[model samples]
Target: MPWGEFKDTVAERRIFQHRTLVALMLLFVMMGVLMARMYYLQVIQHDTYTTLSDKNRVQVQSVAPTRGLVYDRNNVLLAENRPVFNVTIVPERVADISQTLSELQAILNISEDDLDRFRGRLLEPRRPFQEIPLRYDLTEQEIASMAVHRHTLPGVEVNAELVRYYPYSELTSHALGYVGRINRDELQRIDPVNYAGTNYIGKSGIERFYEQALHGKVGYQHVETNARGRTLRVLERENPVPGEDIRLHLDIRLQKLAHDLLDGRRGAIVAIEPKTGGVLALASVPGFDANLFVTGIGVEAYRELNESLDKPLFNRALRGQYPPGSTIKPMLAIAALDSGSTNRERTVWDPGYFQLKPTGRRFRDWKRGGHGWVNLKDAVEQSCDIYFYDVGVRMGVDVMHDYLTRFGFGEETSLDISGALPGIVPSREWKRAHRNEPWYPGDSVNMSIGQGFNLATPLQLATGTAVLANRGVWNQPRLLSDVLGDHDFEEGLFGAARDDIILTDPDTWTFGIKAMEAVMHGTKGTARAAARKAPYRMAGKTGTAQVFSLAEGEEYDEEEVRIRLRDHALFIGFAPVEDPVIAVAVIVENGGSGSGTAAPVARAMFDAWLLGFPAPDEPVLVKSDPGAGE
Candidate 1:
């Protein structure tokens, strides 16, 4: 046993040495592989891994620019941005959107409209991690409640944003219009990068006209976020550029005066500064609050406004088209003189009515027993339909159309006023195209008296009157006076280039002005009562536009016809005939008489703008005077 043990010792030693060498070689190989992997990760793929890590901790966000401020000519703020709290949600971070929305509804008094709007917006294409607004204008209590329950909600947040507000909402609704939330159609048309975080866009009026200058450039920021996607800090920020501030030609004092003048009525008054073509005041009565549409008008509120019989939402100044009535006499008189159809000395016999032929239909004048014989000046002063009927037929449709177009009729003439209609100026072609009928001789007669197929907006009447006031010069009606920033105001926008009217005889302009002046100052003038005791000499033409036509020989009974179907009162005029400062157009819906109802409104506007009397706050009552005729 001792001899066997001694003989195995050398073998055992050799076996142990070999086993130790093999173990050391295996350990060295494992160490080399580990070092190679460490080098590949730390050196070769360093940028890639670092970028991945940062993606989990950081986020890029868009910063919205502040919308431009809007002010009147006197620096009175019309539209402004007010800070508001809104509840927003990030879809990617929410585990269940439906469940989260339910929770939000319970937390806040969210209406079904808001929920529906949110859900609809959720399906629209958007940025990967954009925060969608759920509820707007949250109260402090609602904000506190949301904060208390924030932990349970993953991706919900309360954000402060600048929302549009109108200080004189009711007065300026149709003039300034309003902004609204950007819809999907707007998103597609807008510059994505520039409007990334923007929510509102101009919908109409001054807001829509200068949208590009009002909406500034967007910005970007790098923010650090936690594992739960909550923003911890802003790493880098590129401050956004604020929009350009705009000042309108609108005078707030004059606007208020115009509104007060039309108090308790359904009507419109447009006043323009003739020298500069600046719109001083644009007032549409029974106007709804424009502020209601800023955030989002309630369904019921919007429905009520949309369905109201008074049509408070209608922009009568720019869109309401009606027969110009006898108010068109001044312009037609100029046409007659220029076309050699009639002379200042030419006289037409008016026996209370006119007929194209001896056997033709009798076109009755406003006066039951009209003035016997009248010259051009006498015709204009009396608002005589029969005299115009004679000259209008001589001048023909083509001549009237050409001259009226030059005076800014049958077409949109405003440079910045939006939604203005090119009122109907019936010609052979127009009648053929629209009504599929030939132009009738009676059509020309009706058009001569501002009836039949001829229609015009109050703004158009005002613009035409402005041209007349300016001695055939076309300034192109505009609202924007100046822009207070890098952006400059663009002129001649959305309108044809200006071409001043030059007559064969330059004295025609002077003649037209004098004839219009006679309408206000002359003893037999239709609007003489309205212009009585005026310190300055003004030019005016009053008219009564029929709401419905009478049957062949059927007499008009104002008492029998409903108030809604009564004649519309109209007046177009300008103050201080020598200097020609302000041109105005006034229309009172179903107010009966132009001299009685509409002329007084224009007188008040003139007094306010020129004389600064009967202050805006003064309790001035404008009543219909039966003595005033035409």
Candidate 2:
């Protein structure tokens, strides 16, 4: 042992004890701080920590309310909700959305539209962990495939949802319209919380008009979820209230009759109940199957519909604007009588045509020789153009515009019909604004007979005819008969009330109706042949509207022109004239004579409603007189 490295056992023991004491103090301090932290978390902030922890295990999910159902007057289901499976994905649980989408495409027959729609919805504002639909109406095979790969795809799910379906798709396409996926515009306008899980919305017609009533309140549930965002159990739930079911005044039997009557034709028919203003039947031919639009119509199929010449999507009853032609004659007679331009005993001699000026253009009548001598009753019965031309000119545009407006010619009058156009009733102001031209006397001459700038929809004509049937009483046309719920249908839903059209002479209504009655029963009545064997009396007026102007001394030959370019046939009438129940307006495009083509259709409709001629399942055989008169 070296002398300098001498052992010192006592001093070494003191140094070792001091180091041991310092290490113990440090460990005790660390342990005290750890205990304080544990106490703070476990006791003081227990609720906050538990809440944070439960957030991972539980989620509040939105549940969509079932859509309402639609029924006809006889309780036939028009529109309903059908349960269907859809492929869905929750983005929060998806590891790689792109990769998952690709995998889904490999397993399913997904189109570009499906991918585009999915991406669109993904970009749209949504709540956390909400399931977005990828493909709708999945087939059984697709569902099985998705089930087999469910474990591999974390966020993928097969969700069953109720989708809107129209049973009589083709029969009621225009009347009921349809539902489709909510678009960006709709999303911005809708309440985010209420429509959280809702996907479809009404697109048009009655569905769109009463959308709020049709879509019910949303509900929610607190669900226990696993690490992969899969719902394990429902902790709490609030069931949603289903929408109110609505019943319409439309009769399916009558509607089917109208459709069958107009089969193979491009035209429209609107039948209304004069007493209640309830629409009985509204039919537009060449209608499409509304089902095609419900589940996102394909691009190719939509293109075909959009480009079709027949215009199957066009709602001719409410939207189609036509010249109205001689259908307004009965209405014009009322105007002339009320304005004192002519009286019931007034007579005009027809020399085949009327000259605005002695040498100016001659407005020829449909009859070649003439209806030599005609009174108001005689003219209306015979559909004599010369008599109407005289009265129309005498009444002029101002008096005619004011009086005809009362008959519902130039405005939308339906309580629930959507997309109805206010037809053009040209006055001095209208001509100045629209045509940017002064109102010429010649314009008045043309408008006097429901030509020139006078345009009216089939619905408008029906409404006007209904007003006539009611004898100046106004019942605004409506489709909503009742709402099947505790909520009573508000009378204010029909909008502002319309005042009755009261004339100075109440007898004028009876006189006008008598003249209209003559149109059906009189020996020389143009439509008398159509009313030949009618059990009940009907008051009607037939009309022929020219498509194009004829040059001076030029004649209109039906054989020389194309079918689409021929004159439109029109008729307006009410059956059982004494207690008019049904008033109708019929238009057959390019069908030549109104008496021949359109009047018979009205007769059939009357028989269907009044007599129930053909059984519900029986086939209809309409006998049309192609060469009948105007």
Candidate 3:
């Protein structure tokens, strides 16, 4: 041990202390540089970093808007929202999806389709933690079973959703239309932002036409979430605007009545208010339930509807095209009177048949024997085919075509409802263009009786009858009265103003209307025997449209012909002759004589709507079941 060694150890210790101090000082300077760089990134560039941070934590979720409600004129609920329990799965939160589904299937009856749809949704690349719908309208048993296993199945949830329901399922189906799931084609057309989480859209009829009004505006919510992507609390929210309700002009009571009256009949009945043009009822028989289409319709049900021979999916009221038949008699009578072809008092000899000059082809009348000499008024009252044929030969087809076309015969009625058909009203020009043939005198005679190349829809016939009831003033038919907004606000949607129709002369319509009245009221009237002392006075015309063409000397054989091939019976009428309210048009497919079959249906509809369900004292006239006739 020496004093010099102790001194050297002391010097080394001092040198080590200086080096440690220098290293500590350098470390502090480097730490300061790092802190300054962090400040620039976190404080100066706060907005950029904040957005990046939120991207990792927060997510945007879509909320669906409440759909609108539908009501009849009397405020009877037709379409409404019903609470439905749905089963859902969150992909990111699920531990074992297959095992969880197996447990779910044990309690609920899950169809093969349900599993496939769920799996398909899972495969799509979407946002993390999105709730995929597993099954809709889960039963109570399913909910209870799921509740017991909710804690174990982390991502599974049971939610209550609003589903569309139709109270009168088939009654207002065609008129109200239906809503269905949004498909790839529909999603392209819809605004993804506006639709938000909604999956259904209006597919047809009035629902499709007024989709904007029925689909409410979407809203937003800022929700605070946990690390597991579970909602902790709603930080801020903006409630979605509820869609406006729609009130229809249709009378549900009358609609039901008409539907029942048409029971088993393969035809259409359209009744409208002559003055206002509000359709009381537009019933097409064999209607389908609209609820089946609310969600995705089942394959079997959809196939049945599309393949049915009765064409349940067809909107017969607006789209069915049929021959006007003898119903055009009133229009012919007006044309004859207006064109000076005959006077109201003019008389013609009815020899039971009419012959074309030179060709000498005898056109046989409905009556095998003669109707005897009859005047214009008497001929119309009795529905004498021979008398009309004679007048038609004189009037000519070219003239009749021009006159009938003016009455909206060849064009669509432009009804408020969709899918209206414009029936064919053939002119000399049309015959030449379409058939490549010349219009002859014999053709004119057939057109006179509404038999040759004359066609119309039920809606057109009803509108025409309404025009006659209102004395040539045509009002466009409307099924919707107004659209109702929030706070009970209403705006007139249809029937604001009526359009005047083209007619030869006002006097001619009056004469024809009076003649139609005689058909139901006069002793010789064809429809008189069938109407049988109704409570209110009715003005009507009965028509029997031929279904096929006969050979040179052939006649119709009812037994030999199939029921569907038989002539169509038609009747057009209005109630309380002087002040008409409801103009009814009824077409009974292959139903025997218009007076016997079609007029009776019109009578029943009139009595129910105008006269309040027929008094017990009033005569009960029931139409025989259409199936029995077939």
Candidates' lDDT values, in order?
0.89, 0.89, 0.80
TM-score rank, highest first?
A: 1, 2, 3
lDDT per residue as tens, model 2, 191-291: 88878888889999999988888888899999998988888999999998788899999998889889999877989999999999999998998899999
Q: Evaluate model 1: give its TM-score.
A: 0.95
- All candidates' TM-scores? 0.95, 0.95, 0.87
Which residues of candidate 2, in runs, are more than 4 Å off? 1-17, 123-128, 488-491, 549-561
Count backbone overlaps in model 3.
Answer: 0
- Candidate 2 has its poorest 10 consecutive residues by lDDT at 486-495
lDDT of 3 by residue, 129-247 (tens): 65788788888888898788776677878988898899998988877888886666786778878887776788887778677778888888877676666666776778888878888
Instruction: Sort by lDDT, best first.
Output: 1, 2, 3
Per-candidate total of colliding backbone pairs: 0, 0, 0
lDDT winner between candidates 2 and 3: 2
Give lDDT tens digits, candidate 1, residues 519-625: 89998988888889999999999998889745788675566556768789999999899999999999988888999999998988888888875744568767666
